[model samples]
Target: MMTEPAQNTIIEQHINLDDVADLNDTNPLELLVQATGLSKQRVKDAMTKGAVWLSHGKQARPLRRKNARLRLGEELHLYYNEQVLSETVAKPELIADEGDYSVWNKPNGVWSQGSKWGDHCSISRLVEEHFDYNRQTYVVHRLDKAARGLLILAHNKEAAAALSAMFAKRTVEKHYLAWVNGQFPHDSITIDKPIDNKPAKSIVTLKEYDADKDRSLLSVQILTGRKHQIRIHLSSLGFPIIGDRLHGEPTQSQDLQLMAYKLDFQCPITGDKKAYQLKTWT
Candidate 1:
């Protein structure tokens, strides 16, 4: 059997080449050396190891070819995440493999997609690397960096668009589990608040309340996809999720006590109703 490769620690930083007028049309290697104050050979080594990236506005590409030219005002991003640079790979546990779409349990610390740094630690990249076929994977939805559990991906663009549409149309039902500080007032409550100037709704159900612990376990369902919707809504209710450092008061635990617990939706590609559940923090 083949052993999985070792994961690398990836470090990253960004440098803007906006004011370097003389560096226009100069070789990327030369500019990177000047920008980073590293030797040409060191810069070359970093580039060869897949650490250097070039960005033009929202589009970013890794620098691979030798003697690549740098356009004026282009951005160079250096990835120093040594963990990602190493052979260590993060393998996502595949839950179910549909023909056009699949479900996987996304663990905390794994990105849903690639960023300016690299794709090595991203779920999309990991999923693609897991398979040998030229077939690609597309992200249908995203789970937060600190949140865990059910994530769906599409094998092709058709499935991607369909699944994404389901989310946008509110045809998909998503439930999350969380532990919050203090006792909640209602057994089930709805939070209807505008998030980022967009309509956002959240339904929260109190599953359990421990008086001795002064904590409540909740099931949350979001009706809109807004950034930090659950965290913001729950905190607005004065019962912030435990371990949520950003929304709640800092606790000794650094792990966020939130997980995507269940999902129910019709398969846009197969036209079959589907449901999935994964118990977390129960």
Candidate 2:
């Protein structure tokens, strides 16, 4: 039988010039900054700290200058102490579809959209990449990056306008599931809070309980769309969602345990009930 190699073994080798020549085409500082998304000063500081390594198998010392110049086949090892930007988009399965609108099951840790540079992975980019370019796409609403569950997308301008109006008008029904920190006192409670001049209402129903963990699972229905409405409302009730950084009981976990589990809306064009439910639960 063959034995597997040790995990910590470091394998180093000498390669031909053509392999790393493209790295020399750009300045080292520029390449490092682009690769690590660090400022020039930070890169220089790393160099001073012996964090940068050259092809000659030499660690960059303080006396060593910070230059971008390199010969062909020179190996560059950069030690970055930051999270690397994700380039791939999270593609959720399409649940429901209309002429110009569709619903998807968005998983946790995926952004709904990103900034102009497209430096970060996002759901919008994923949809755009999968759909026809002639059609315009827009997010009718947003879910927190850490929150999972159902999300609605509009394929064209008309669909976007209609769905946006539905959200603004409070015609769409949104339901969520949250694993909260403490036991809820009441069986059901309605929260009416003003969010950004819009009246937001949520009906929370306790579903399950874990006595050992002192936690309760809740089914939350939102009558209005507001940024962090469910999370904020639950937090205000003193039973913040477990693992929620913004509102949860502070410990070590920073991820929110809330999920947008279900969405029900009337299709603007088809006039049919558009309901989407998430099959996966974490």
Residue pairs with backbone overlap in model 2? 28-68, 243-255
User: 1-282, model 2: which lDDT tens digit per residue?
Assistant: 323224332222223334544754665665566555556775565454334556654533111246656666455555533232223445676777675877877777778875322213567656665674455568888888888888888988888988888887878788899988778887999999887788888999998888998889899998877888998898888888888776665564656788888878787777888777776565
- Which candidate has the highest TM-score of all? 1
What's the lDDT for all of these models? 0.79, 0.69
Error of 2 at 11 (Å): 33
Q: Model 2 RMSD to the real structure? A: 12.1
After TM-score superposition, the amount by which residue 251's alpha carbon in candidate 1 deviates from its true location, in angstroms, is 5.2
lDDT of 2 at 78: 58
